[model samples]
Target chain A: MKIFIDPPNSLILFDLVERFGHEPLSVMATIQERVDNLEIDMPPMNVTLTDVKNGLKYAGIEVPSGIRGRLAVWGPLIDQAEAAIIMEDAPYSFGCVGCHRTNLLVDFLVRKRKLPTIEIDYPRTEEDARNMVIRVKEFLEGLK
Target chain B: MVRETRLVVISPLSEITPDQITRKVHSLGYEVTVKETCYGAVLEGPPETVSKVMQELRALDPLGIYSKIRGFPLGDPKRCRAQHGSRPGFSQLQTEWQSLSLVEKGLECALRGDKAEDIDIPERIPVKDLQRFCEEVE
Candidate 1:
């Protein structure tokens, strides 16, 4: 299945659609695009964010205790994602220290549950998203 | 004359000559200024262009390149050290340490393998400690 990983409403979503074939979109983007197209509204978006926020608070993902409160507030939706379009220049993965820390929880889930995975080449600029998606499409094409 | 920063290449007298260095510097669009310094030589231009010229010069002779040179704004040496020392990454702990009241500091110090009573402290208490004390008394 083609995957579009949307981590919170960040640019990685667009990059993912660029990388993987966009036949079926990621759930988060579908929600955002739906909202944009007037099919959904802010009320539903707020509700979804709240639900994801609460779910992550109780998930018991560990970091230093000092950082946990902030993480619990911002981390849930990102952590819950089964897949993602990791940006090449993002502080986390490309060259940042926090990259592995953010991916640690989900990586564990993939190992234990045998989740299908795709690691897209990092996209550096907004314009690169198109090429990134095409690359993803080529990758999926190879699978077929 | 517009003052521009550029990298000046210097080498030991035995290594390279004025003519050879001048040709390389000119090719990189830098005018060699002083060529007879003990270390090597100097060039002048915009800081970025000078940096590129410097890199090229370094590549031309690796053993002769003693330091990575770049330009930055100059400031008061003491104030610069103080301002840099106050950066959040390092000064945050100091702030936390200072913000603690004598009792809290005592408590923290005690937890860290020191006797709370043994630590000498002045009597002024922080409002946070006073509020905590009031709550306990109530």
Candidate 2:
């Protein structure tokens, strides 16, 4: 199963999902593909015009390009996901904190999909960490 | 040729000391800059050198040591926890650091070829029950 994690770039979530025998749809893998593409000159700065247009599928033309641009990257991943794990109340640095609007839009889309999902809080203590891993493990195992 | 930075975390359950990691890295004589942290050490240098250092570091304790690429370069004041009181992700990193012991245990179990049957996970609440609870709260 492809599991979509809220903070899409979280290594902890990525590692846990993969360790539990599921693929984690993460930002690192997405961005790495774009960066590796030779056709795009100067990489991240040079978002192909076509890529910007692709955002229209998720957002209207009137929406800010930043949100659209983000959607262009994340929208497809969300569509591919069979399940999702959301970590709530994470600090800004926990994952891609580039655009708040994109985060909200992505979250709304994930829930709207109505897939098997589990929302967990960011662990602040050792006990919480233990519980977080256990819940993640159980959730992934259930999917099998 | 892109330079890179990486965070290497040592599991709390491991007997390896941070000093041991620091000394071992320095002994390798790479051009990498190393910052010793509470969890482990941060390395910054050419991607190849960083990768080499990580390979050697992990060899010290394969299951006990873990490494991940960092988004920022070393000592970037905007993201440095020391310069700015607790940079955006430091708390998350700290919290994750606390959980390394559990991860290490899981890795050990995998190495021993054991299943996760030992863990006692409770029965999950059905979606209908959760919806009812939400409706009651509303």
Candidate 3:
């Protein structure tokens, strides 16, 4: 399953999902792939307003001003996801995702896409950790 | 006074193991449990001690260590915010934090000064303009 992990930058979740044999899809890796293949040597970006507008639609972010910028980067991430794992209260995100607006949209998108999702919190204790792993494992296994 | 606690991750490029990390962390003398997670160990402990340990670990391997702050402020009751009977809480301050965790990756691609080419910006939002906007966020 191509599980779309929001915050897709999480090292732990990325590893765990892959270790279990499911492909982990993240916005970072997707964006990196796009940037790496930019048309040989034109400027960094040579896109138009319509292209960005479409990206916003794909990414599910709706704002009057800055949505275009965010959509440009995250649009493809939404395109490639099959399932989702939304980890709440992830320990030490280090400012990777700060906009609550985007957060809500991600939630909205998961619902809109009707993707199978498992919403969880970063564990605070050994028991919590154990249960979290079990829940995640069960969710992944169910995918098969 | 509120004490600080955190969940720290020590990622060693290809040079170390969780056991080695546990040993190194143990030598520091703070009481923490170093759990063996996928990329490395996730150690939980007081903030100051965790910071010192993280610094030492980084010195051992400059670009490999990573640490993360967990839920509430270490020991601050105000973070509780329920006011006992007044407020209904965000229900819990840390409950939905992970949802707000992805913009940094976007910032990285968009704010790349010269070598930036990740997405299709809608003209008005140039990379330089986005970089400036990112700088002002915090």
lDDT of each: 0.37, 0.74, 0.52
DockQ values of all predictions: 0.01, 0.14, 0.02
Candidate 2 scores a C-alpha RMSD against the true structure in Å of 7.2
Q: Tell me how much of the true interface, by contacts, candidate 3 captures.
A: 0.00
Docking class of 1: incorrect
The order of the candidates by lDDT, greatest first, is 2, 3, 1
Tell me what fraction of the real C-alpha contacts between chains A and B each candidate also makes: 0.00, 0.12, 0.00
Which has the greatest lDDT?
2
Q: Supply candidate 3's per-residue lDDT for A57.
A: 60
Model 1 has how many clashing residue pairs? Answer: 9
Which clashing pairs does model 2 show? none
Cα lDDT tens digits, model 2, B85-112, are 7755576667666667866665555455
Please report, as a value between 0 and 1, the fraction of native contacts recovered by candidate 2. 0.12
lDDT of 3 by residue, A1-144 (tens): 898776555654654465456877754454333333446232222334655676666454446434454455555566667788888776533222545666666667766778888887665543444455556666777798
lDDT (10s digit) by residue, model 3, range B1-138: 223333344432336666767788888777654555444555555546665776676566543344343333322343333533311212222332222122222222223322322233256778898899999995
Q: Could you tell me the TM-score of candidate 1?
A: 0.27
Top candidate, metric TM-score: 2
Q: Tell me the tens digit of each residue's lDDT in model 1 across B41-131.
A: 4455444665566567657654333221212112313224475542121232222122222222222332344421222338899999999
Off by over 4 Å in 1: A6-20, A23-58, A61-113, A121-135, B1-138
Quantify how close model 3 is to the true structure by its C-alpha RMSD in Å: 20.6
